[model samples]
Target: MDAIDLASLLCSRLCHDLLSPVGALNNGIELLADEQDPDMRERCMELLSESARASANKLKFFRLAFGAGGGFGDEIDTREARTALEGLYGADKRIDLGWMVTDEKMAKGAVKLLLNLGMIAGDALVRGGRLDVGAEQRDGALEMVIRAEGPRILLDPKLREVIAQGHSGGEVEPRAAGAWLAHSLASQAGGSIQLNDPADEVLLIGVTLPN
Candidate 1:
């Protein structure tokens, strides 16, 4: 992998992760300056605290998964990965997380591959669903799979094209942007993404990350 390309990917990942909390902080401050009620002030504080915690958890998760240190050149902490996945789910989202891998450090490439796959799975469930994620170490390599099952599976054609490498940056629909990004990241990491058609009320995404 080219160092410059890797650096660019990491930069994009970091910027994406920080936007949520920063936006929340700005909104919370604006509300505080205008609202005068004591109860409302307490509510704003709570919002700020929740957003801050979410941001911190995401950063910690990404540091190990995408940063230069923490097993990038070696194996990743599987326990930490599990915790990070759960933390990203948060309390508001109604998604279930499942694990089927041994508690061991995965390679840096595998970590990045899984993170992008997780983003795809999370995005598939708009009205809420079960996100079943699993990884198996087979023949000294990792094979990851993410299954998104929900009532309604919204598949965007443009996003599908992005996953298939048929399109690049364009005025694509916003709802499918996450999956498109996931596809792009996977492509950059020397991995492949497979999205099963909307059949049997399930949207399955399978990825293979070469070690």
Candidate 2:
């Protein structure tokens, strides 16, 4: 597929994710306007605030992981990427985050791969779990590892296939957008991405990027 096609797929994925929060925001606004009861109005306001926060967090993450992120820099601060992940997953308070990335900086593409991989792993924790993300730079290369542990984890079969083999041979879908994006970035950089297996207790996503 060409750049436009890939972009379209990613956009579709983003829209799918944001639709819920945006719809909730709209619904909350409508309810607030029609409600006369103080308690009901207060609940609507809370819903609006929550929807707004969720929308903002997802936007921030997509900007960094897929957009220009308001810069032309080749490298971005690792902390910025971690904060984006925190906003995306940790803010919900369902998934506990364990950040072990000690590096001060990383290539922008590398950071995108890291973020997308972490997002995928964290999402696999179907029931609420712990996600540990770690990265290190050594000998002119960067290594990233993400582990998700929980009572139950389910990585979709299609996503696992895309992550393990790539989408070169099959049609890319919106649900596989993140995995495809990560694989594309890694391929461009001559790096590697290791996917998860159904037998494993903890889902692991590993990557290595040249420096």
Best by TM-score: 2
lDDT: worst 10-residue window of model 2? 63-72
Error of 1 at 79 (Å): 1.7
Residues 1-211, candidate 2, lDDT per residue (tens digit)?
Answer: 8778779888998999899999999999999889999999999999999999999999988888878667739888988898889999988899999999987888788888988888888889989899999999878888889999999999998888878677866688887888888888988989998866689888988888887
The sequence of per-residue lDDT tens digits that candidate 1 reaches over residues 59-136 is 876665556544346667777777777787745667777776664877665665576567556666777788777888
Deviation from truth (RMSD, Å), model 1: 4.1
lDDT per model vs. reference = 0.69, 0.87
How many pairs in model 1 have backbone atoms within 3 A of each other, for residues 3 or more apart or on separate chains, i.e. clashes? 2
**Candidate 1, 181: how far from true, in Å?**
7.4
Off by over 4 Å in 1: 1-20, 33-36, 64-66, 69-73, 164-192, 209-211
